[model samples]
Target: MELHNVDLNLLVVFDHLLRLRTVSGAAKALGLSQPAVSNALARLRRIFDDDLFVRSAKGMLPTPLAQELAEPVSYALEALQNALNRKVSFDPRHSDRDFRLAMTDIGEIHFIPRLMGTLRELAPGVSVATVRNTAVNLAEEMSQGKVDLAVGHLPELTSEFFQRRLFRQRYVCMFRPGHALDKRTIRLRDFLEADHVVVTAAGTGHARADEILARQGVQRRIRLRVPHFAALADIVASTDLIATVTHKFAERSAKYFGLRYVKHPVDLPEIQINLFWHSRYHRDPANQWLRTQVFDLFSE
Candidate 1:
């Protein structure tokens, strides 16, 4: 395809289709009629000489060629958007922008409340949405701009993304104030014997706590598993289940939910929570401002 003959608008359609996966979904996302989106997709297919997307039980699955083009197309559209909106300054007080964040339940519990309060004071019209973090293809999701920012202990983050260390957190043992273990400091032996409430957001599989225990040739009996920190904390506060959670979360819950915490028996590694964004948005003025605000709020 000649550069002069290629219609740039098709790139926007392609990006939308890649994200939404269905023609109707893409049309809705782009605010275009289905016929219009279909026409654009047809043009894109002819130019690329690929079907691009094939119908499947799980909606429109992208062909390998489409998958290969996804990131570049998204990046190009983002660049074009930035270029066209170069004069627009992000005035949080007046702008009605929605910032989407990918974070763990712990992050939502400890950070979002304070962050939203700050936003209320500084950027009243701005909104926030949180997506749960999963242990799969996080970099790809960030690259596609499905999430504006991601905050967690993401060991899988690629160097292609830009990241900032938000804060370092230690783990603590949590239980109801009057649980059997409340009167004494927890020991490694006690931890191994007690029933634990494990927060496995991604699923019931390997977790940091389990890995630490495995290193010592000890395993805790996980009586319950939950998907979010909030749920784990709630169960620990109301029941006899003990949970190991970030110190930030434990402390916050202690203050808010009348929960109690004690030092864990084993020396668990300190978890470093970082904020990540796609490199494509690293220099974006609005994103930069928001990132700075988030870092400042959380670091404090």
Candidate 2:
């Protein structure tokens, strides 16, 4: 296709349509009328010589070619946006940029309260959406601008991701007050014998803590494998079930739940919880400001 044959703006529409999976959503996000977005979609189809999206009961479904175009088109548009918006100053006190983040439930519970306390004073206009729907494709989502940042021990950080280490995360055993092992110092044997409630890996059936334990040849009775840390608090407070959680989260959980924490008897290496973003957004001013706030929050 010739350079003049393609309109770059249509690619922006396509990118949003793919991200949102609906023409009306793309229209709303792009500040364009639904007919305008529909017109752009029609032009995109003719230009690419393919039906870019199919109207579905769910939403607009991208064709294989449109799916293939999603990445590079998104990258190009973001790079162009960054170039154009580079000098745009970010005033947190007044700017209403909505930051989308991909964070685990543990990170959300552990960080949001403190982060919001500061934001409420400094960046009241700024809003946030911490999305968990993209955990399986976090790196891709960040690169595409679907997620602005992510926090946690992201084992998926590859070359595509840029991360800044925030804090080293260590595990602790938490249980109700006056449980079987409450007064006694926990031995590795006692921990292994206790029934436990574990948080499964996001978007999967396995739990990283369990995987680590299994690698060390430790056998424990897993009474439940939940998908989030929020659920563990109630279960641990009522049953013989003990929970292994990151030290910070465990410490925080103790404030609300009648729980006590002890050092994990086994020598599990500390994992670093880092702030991660796509390299594509490295130079974006709003993203830079948000990242700075996150760094400051944890550093203090």
Q: In order, how many clashes per candidate?
A: 0, 0
Candidate 1 collision pairs: none
Q: Please write out the lDDT profile of model 1 over residues 1-300, one tens digit for every residue.
A: 677898888888888888888999989988989999999989988999999998898988899999998888888889988998878467878889888888766677777889999999999999998876674466777788767888888777777788898888777888888787885687777777778888765521227766777788777787887766656666777788888777887888888889888887888778788888999888777788889998998773
Q: List candidate 1 stretches off by more than 4 Å.
A: 1-88, 203-206
**Clash list (residue pairs), candidate 2:** none
Consecutive 10-residue window with the lowest summed lDDT within model 2? 201-210
Model 1 misses residue 229 by how many Å? Answer: 2.2
Q: How close is candidate 2 to the true structure, as a TM-score?
A: 0.68
What is the C-alpha local distance difference test score of each model? 0.81, 0.83
lDDT of 2 by residue, 59-141 (tens): 88999999898888888888998898867678999898888887778778988999989889999999998987435477778
Off by over 4 Å in 2: 1-86, 133-136, 203-206
